[model samples]
Target chain A: MNTKIENKLTPVRIIAFIFVALWLVIAMFPFIWTLWGSFKVQADFFSKADWLNAIFGFHTEKQTGGFFTMDGYYGSWIEEEFWRAVINTSIVVFFTVLISLTFGTLGGYALARSTYRYAFWILMAGLIFRAMPHMTLISGYLQPFFAWNVWGILPTTIIVLVAINQPFTLWMLHSFFLNIPKDLDESAMCDGCNRFQAFRYVIIPIMWPGVITTGLFSFLLAYNDFTVTSMLLSDENETMIPAIASFLGTVQEEGKVMYAVAAVVSATAPLFFFVLFFQRQIVSGLTAGAVKG
Target chain B: MKHSTFLLFSLPSLSVMFLFIAIPIVSVFIQSLHIEHKQVIIVTENCDPFGCETTTAVDTEASAKLKEKAPLGKFNGFKTYSNRMHFAFDEVGEAWKSSDSFTVFTKKLYNYPLYRALSFTLTYTFVVTPFVLFLGFLVAVGVNNLPKMFKGPTIFASLLPMIVTPLVGSLILFWMVDGDGVIGATLQKIFNDNSLSLKASPVLTWIMLMVYGIWHLMPFSFIVFYAGLQTVPQETIEAATIDGASKFQRIRHVVIPHLMPLAIFITLILLMDNFRVFEPIIGFRAEAHATSISWLIWNHLRESAYPLYNAAGATSMVTIFGVAILLLPVLIRTWRDFKEKNKG
Candidate 1:
């Protein structure tokens, strides 16, 4: 069987393998290079005489007598106070996910259960809203946020992020709810449970997978957001993305490009782990809408 | 469920959407009509000691009264929309009449901010969307045929580009392609041109930005298409094979039709997403060579001395209109789908 399978490996199969392997390298090389480069001193990573100097830390050894150093991460996280941005991001992501999931689950469940045309219209409105460039909404938000003096706070940014996240979350959760057999919930309703009670008791347990999937996306949205957070939050309340961006903005003059490089790797580390643990859900969550629609 | 119960369930989401989404949309349109209040500056000459000096100061009292009257700024109607940065009716007209050649006309057209951004945005959107889709479909097909053990790690690796924050992803690629960076040094050596740099010129910058656009977004399409390929029925493939269909023929006749809906779905999503391409421009620092509608709005809003809220609002309105136009077909298709389902 092994010999027969090997015999069937034609030129086309070889080409396909080669192509896939090349793409895999293309996809993974930058990240690995940057992650490794982040541990080297700036001079070594940016060495012009030899590119291998970046991979091997030759210059860094000459200066610090070490192949690797944590100085970049230290300078970024401690000296530049990237920890504050990390803290702000954590707070924002935590609240945004919690609030969006809560509302999204309830709203999505309601939409799924309802047979009325209004639900369809609401979903349609959500589709349109989701399609709008977020910056457009931010433009409107700036005025009212300024007038009301609620522009820069964490809660305000969280609320805005939640609102922006709602359409996608609702749509995802709605589909998830639709997949659950209605008979399960109807029986709970027959057992003297109110609508909310049925949802809470009958549906909530089975809804974890979908909720987790939706919550993962919400977390990603809030955590990865740059346009909204950058526009809404003030300098002091900057999140990791905007903070990293500011580093780039001034790094040319400061000769601190490695600091920004370290921060980029730092910001990407959580997402790397996120995909690792939640790969199944992330895939399902992404394709849920496409498959259902 | 009872209507009241349903309402109770959806009330939180509905109210939040209303306050944020609906209201802001209305306010964008309203704000687009108004421009910033221009201060009345008074210049006075005061003879002091040996010399007469002229000082110019904003008439604070007049400005304060103007602020009280129209706090959002003076109502400019459609003036902002037609200005040089936006529609540029006048500039276009002048360019149209005076330019003797197409190249000169385009050069003149590039002078308008809106046109410049629009040209690059449309190019990026149209170019990136189709290329990513094609590349993604190829990868999905290639990866699906990989040995099972390689599948999981391949997917995990591919997800990095799509899942990493766009700015960070672009920055990672940006650093790699910088003059002294590894990729850059290699390119310089290969070309034997020491001055070779990707970021210095417009054509190269645009290409790099497009390359970044494809690199960052192709993984999303790949994952989506990979999932889509799983649903292709095995029986159909076997039947096609039994009928003496070649691999290419089977894919063309069976798989392509099977995934057409998904293809369309991804296309719609890609169009909308690419239409608002902003982060890559910032990440690549390609603003010197290319700009998008969203970036134009950011530029207006980020003006340090005087934020052009009105200009930003107008650009926002234009972007909203563009998105709506792009969404119309998808909306119609969705509506038709709903109607067909209801009929069935």
Candidate 2:
């Protein structure tokens, strides 16, 4: 028993534990620190006189008559009208996910079900297309959109985002549809149902898990995107990430660093909850490519 | 399904991909060869008793005709690719002849925008990829060994860094590394230097960016590797232990081989992802110190009064070229798989 216990407490195990603990701290400390700092006033948060005031909130309490205050969130959400950005982000994400999934599922089902040689080439093309930096395509969109007077609107950006998201969604959903045994839909077709009816009746029910997984990733892409939205959208149509970025750029001149911090935390909050709920799907989705490959 | 049915099924995605991906690729290449139309300025000299004045105005009709002829730009034939911002062959040759020492040659090389961005991009990609993989492997092994009760929360906590929006995650780190922020202040105190700032110097900025890259991506690598670990063969480990092998020896000889393929997959994904490093630079406001190729394109698009569409196109083509080269191994593997599938 003594030897077994000592073996379990080996030096390597101890070191591993220490390293993991340290990493956990490193990974979490910045977000926790910023979250704490968001509630403080500019003086306490950015206090040059003493850094401890940021943690202790001494000046914040003195100024706001409390240790924590909601002034930063108030300023960011209400006064700055960050709600406009929030609404725009929601609209973009909703439409992007909807359009991407609709096209992706159909295309993916075709790729998985077809016996044609073209399906392989199509997937290969998608893989290459997916590897291209999105900004490359955005450059091409700028001139045409400008000439057509269609640049800098939510709808154009949404469509562009959907286009950009197609490759990844198709790839993920293709592989996922592959995993569903063909017998399910084939048998349904054997029962005198047409191909569309088989797909609609048999495959759709079983494909929800895959669709949900792909949709979650699509939502993340559209929600987290900065490059496409920032370059494509006009100022009034700015999304949350781009708005936060603009805040960062102007914080010094505007003296609203706290607002930016609060905005960062707010933007992160939804994703935090998203991960909390969808941890299993995300983990499975991420590893799916590796496992299949 | 019939061929027509298959075609119909794929039509929506195919149309979108063709219009967006395929056409844009061709357009980027074509646009790189073209330049924005220049307005024709007509200058008229008016004689007066006080002085002779020259009034210059853009010839709107001529400009409009020129624009109608070629809306994108005139055909410049790769001028943007060869200019100071891109390949800079002439300047590089001049620098090579003028500089007597290697250090001076490098300093001059850094003056070129493409080289500057390439150096940072390459360094960030190579450095971040290995460190993230190693740390991820370590975390995976550690978590795999943890008590069953601790695993769920640990995994959840680890996922936060990755699952959070990249820009927001980087911002959270950026604020902490501010001079007055907690981490920055602590570093200053530890180093006993009052003026220490991570963002003030190029080297430190690159280091911070790399750290952020690792922090943001390690969780992804970890989760994938952890899942791989679950599938590791149990019998081999038991047999190695039965043969009186140490834990380290077993891991080295047995476990690593099992995890090698997963490691390669993670590396491929990481390489593709990190090669397009843009968000962290924006979030950290590190353009002053470092810029990647994607950032260079963004700067061209955003910073200029007239968006440098040609230059952006050229840089994007270069980025695409680089990504294609980097993706060669994956492409070869995919082709092999396809061939094998057809054979079987």
Error of 2 at A146 (Å): 1.3
Error of 1 at A20 (Å): 0.7
TM-score per model (chain B):
0.95, 0.97
CAPRI quality band, candidate 1: medium
Against the true structure, candidate 1 reaches a TM-score of 0.97
TM-score of each: 0.97, 0.97
Encode model 2's per-residue lDDT on B1-344: one tens digit a residue: 68998988999999999998899889889999999888989999999999999999999999999988878779999789999999998999999999999999999999898999999999999999999999999998887766566677878889889878889998888877888776787788889899999999999999999999999999999999899999889899889999999988988999899988999989988998899999999888898889999999999999989899899999999999999999998899889988998899
Which clashing pairs does model 1 show? none
lDDT tens per residue, model 1, B84-137: 879999889999999999999999998888989999989999999999999999
DockQ for the candidates, in order: 0.75, 0.66
Native contacts recovered, each model: 0.73, 0.64
lDDT of 2 by residue, A188-292 (tens): 889999999999999888889999999999999999999899998999999999999888777657888888888988998898789889989999999998966
